[model samples]
Target: MKAAREARSAAVVINAGSRRGAASTELAVDAMRRAGVPVRSVHPVKSGTELFQTLRRVVADGHDLVVVGGGDGTMTSAAGLLAGTDIMLGVLPLGTANDFARTLEIPGGLTEACAVIADGKVVDVDLGWANGEPFLNVASVGLSVGVTEALSPRLKRRIGSLAYGIATMQAYARHKPFRARLEFPEGDHEPMELEDVLQVAVGNGRHYGGGNIVSPMAGIDDHTLDIYAILAAPLREHVKIARLLKDGSFIEHDRVYHLATRRVRLVTEPPLSVNLDGEIAAVTPADFSVQRNAVHVIVPQSSNSASFEGPSRH
Candidate 1:
């Protein structure tokens, strides 16, 4: 994938449904071209189906670069298509929570992001997989899934990043505790059974839930998945934990169990929806693995996030 691309052109795909997607599409296209990238095709797609088709076509067309605009969900979709391939991804963070972009230190402004695409270096980043679906940030079950359901488009457009907090609170009231077991495939840890869990999350990248850290030690290029299972607790205790979420110190709480491994398997009593980034990508009885250096992307030259050398695919 490190080899030179025969055609050095780039395609841009922006998800129109995202908060700033519709507003930023044309600006992104113009700014990218202005930044001196070899821009070819530009698409402001309104649906996931269209976004999929457009990304597939650009890859088939042999474009050297694929510039994706929108949130984590849109980036997750693009990663599924572009991972393990030679094409480089240029991100435009135009959604409510640009979690993946934040992990890479890719700024939020259209002009700044475009500049990075044009002048940045390429680096390989890991993607977490749940039942074969790819996610650039955290993937989880339980209350997080409810939060995803509560995040309506109108609500996000109105409150921006604050929407995540509002939705989490709204979902918390209706969250149902579930039972589950975790088995580490690498045998790094003994299998464990658990009961009445608020959430079980497997994180590949550091930032999620807007700007919350998965763990202080977690990193997208770390080649390991960060796993955390928070035991359901009393309201008074949970409020204290919520305060620690922003700094990822919540993982140190007595109720929050944390581990880092290459892979793990999660099984729930009554299969529950799994939230991958923001989309419900899978259900329980899930197999989770770290796709180490699964995707190559552009990031600011000043970013300390990923290794500049490309991935060595096994």
Candidate 2:
């Protein structure tokens, strides 16, 4: 226990703007201290830009581990700073969706999450890149981008993950079909084009959009990104596809196109907004690639989604 406690020194950063952070911050800090993990600092950040800067400072100050408490977007913002370094990233999952946390099998509760960090099992995982930014879950355009743009913070705090569904419905009503071309750029695959594409989601991990599984077999350690593109079809057909997606069987649908590749470039007619792990990452005419084993994360030993490789010492 003493060896594990001394394995990595940690600093905690809680995004105070997250829905549950205010309620869970004290509890999380207490749980970590009780489990004997040495916490060097605690920071409460108000925005993604602030969180990113704070994370860089924490790493620079010699802390080898950073326990970030927020939703997927906040965590992904930190990944841009922590990627390729030897720092061990720890998650607290105090957000509305926590989609990336679901991918990691990190517990939703503060106590269990803090306990996982205390256990100190580290594993290297793949990262999805969209126009040079690193993301742990999905990078998407079309309908999901509209959803991110329409989703309000008040609604999110009131209804949590259901806020995504509400915003999605509204986005769908206003969504327009657009031409999309997908190219391998680096992988061994031919280019593909679609006439009317409603949405394109490239997933590095299994889940996105508040628990929707973009690909059933996708994993952060798999070294590939799974692409799910929703082709424009009749409303009835879309309803059927939506049912399959809700059932976690969207892969079997015909109108949905799936690809697993090392790198991809997407060109859309008239440029669209792209959401990465729930935040607006970039605009369309974008490039994406997989950074295999780019970041190390702390997870529980029992987590099937991520296997424990060993301890990380920087």
Candidate 3:
């Protein structure tokens, strides 16, 4: 295994509320230690508020690396605090979906993930912003907000990734068409307005919605955001697009408008909720942009989703 130049001193934070978090907290620390990581501190948080405080505390403590465990929502919180800093992040995927971890090619198992953190290379990755709040995966409007609302903790813990499908079905039946105005500040594309839209999403990383590809060309280190808006269509056509979402071919359909840009301003007709990662964190008229190379993350050496810019690239 290649040696990482990042400091061995690290702190760990895990959201005990996540699906596998409570059971794996002790295991994660032990694995990291066994893998030769010099863990300095640990925090097991149970709520978003507690997580926020714990991350802030860890950042304030001046540790060179912080190992975070949880899903997309949990990782997003760490990103906001660690962005634009030298504090490297080690990931342990312990939540449902774990889309953020998937984008980085981090393994899902506890021991294997710790091995990556111990021996992986560090790289810079982009983060998406919504009204100044940082998000790791996708920030979405309309239908996704409904899906987030429908995805109760119980449902996720019981059925795992299948929860996304069941929640989508529930949200789909109650979905309402809305309108959105899109403007690109970089002048990459002309401003446009669309009506009867099912959802509008801006993706910072590739995989989301339990491993659904954002777009065929998407990458977390690409320094661009992938934007897409799905307009309502006839029943048969809508079903076809839905079937293609897993691989991001949904963007090829006429009803699905897609683009890649540095920044975009979205204005909704009635100011609907925005789901950032998995949390309802912002509301439209929200501004979305890519924070290029904003996070220093450790990934498996064999992973290619992001560029190897950290020490020990060879």
Model 3 residue 141 CA deviation (Å) reads 0.3
List pairs with backbone clashes in candidate 3: none
| Worst window of 10 by summed lDDT in candidate 3 | 305-314
Candidate 1 regions exceeding 4 Å error are 1-7, 312-314
* Candidate 2 residue lDDT tens string, 103-202: 8888999899999888857777777888987788889889888899879989999998888878988999999999899999775788998878989888
lDDT to native, each model:
0.89, 0.82, 0.90
Find the 10 residues in a row with the least total lDDT in model 1: 1-10
Is candidate 1 or 2 superior in TM-score? 1
CA displacement after TM-score superposition, residue 18 of candidate 1 (Å) = 0.7
Candidate 1 C-alpha lDDT tens digits along 202-281: 99999999998999899999999999999999999999988998889999999999999998999997799999999998
Candidate 1 lDDT score relative to the true structure? 0.89
Residue 83, candidate 2: how far off, in angstroms? 1.2
Model 3, 254-287: lDDT tens digits are 9999999999999999889999999999988999
Error of 2 at 161 (Å): 1.2
